[model samples]
Target: MRIVVPIKDNSGLESEVCEHFGRARYFVFIDVEDGKVKGSEVIEVPFKEHEPGDLPAFIKEHGGEVVLAYGMGRRAIAYFNTMGIEAITGASGRVKDLVEALLKGALKVDPEWRSKGDFGRHEF
Candidate 1:
């Protein structure tokens, strides 16, 4: 399986997961087979600032089947789903630990913060 995780640096599995998906400094793509990691690659977002739906499109082009993010808005989640890619939020940790937990089915999804109440949904 190919999983895309947005992180703060180029530290490979040691990179800290970024707090916002689209705002992450780098995207680490990890490949897993038989419950073990095969390898990982990094994607640096282009120099141009992001626009709506840009990152999602970039992820789709990179063979990403799933996304592990800190917190994402409902629209972004739905956008990924439409592309047949799964989005899991409320994830935070070093890249390796989070990947292990995900492979073990141990990452929890907090529904209260998922839909309309996440980091980007504020209208104030």
Candidate 2:
């Protein structure tokens, strides 16, 4: 499976995960098999400016099956859902660790947790 994790830096598996999906600076795209990371690549989010619809399209273009983000707005989340792409939010910590946990069925995503305040900032 192809999984995409928002990353703050591209140093290694220990790099911090980014908070926002659309505005994330970089995304660590991993190819998993048998619950292990077989291959991976860091793709830079084209620019800082992006709309809710653009996110899903970008994921689709990159052949992403799942998105691991710190926090995603309702519109963006809905867009991913519409595109049949799983959006996992409230994620923090290392990008590779998150992917590993997800592949191992250790990570549980709470899709119901919605931001009530400003949509851009990090809350969890």
**Top candidate by lDDT:** 1
lDDT of 1 at 77: 83
Q: Model 1 segments beyond 4 Å from truth?
A: 109-118, 121-124
Please give, for residues 1-124, the per-residue lDDT of candidate 2 as tens digits.
8888878877546677776665567778888887788988888777567655876788789999988887777787888898889888887788767877887779865454455325554222
Give the RMSD in angstroms, all C-alphas superposed, for model 2: 3.3
Query: Model 2 — which ten-residue stretch has the worst lDDT?
Result: 115-124
Clashes of 2: 0
**Tens digit of per-residue lDDT, candidate 1, span 26-120:** 89999999999999999887644766667788999999999998877667788898999999888888899999989998876555545433466
What does candidate 1 score on TM?
0.86
The per-candidate count of clashes, in order, stands at 0, 0
What lDDT does each candidate get? 0.82, 0.75
Q: Which candidate number maximizes TM-score?
A: 1
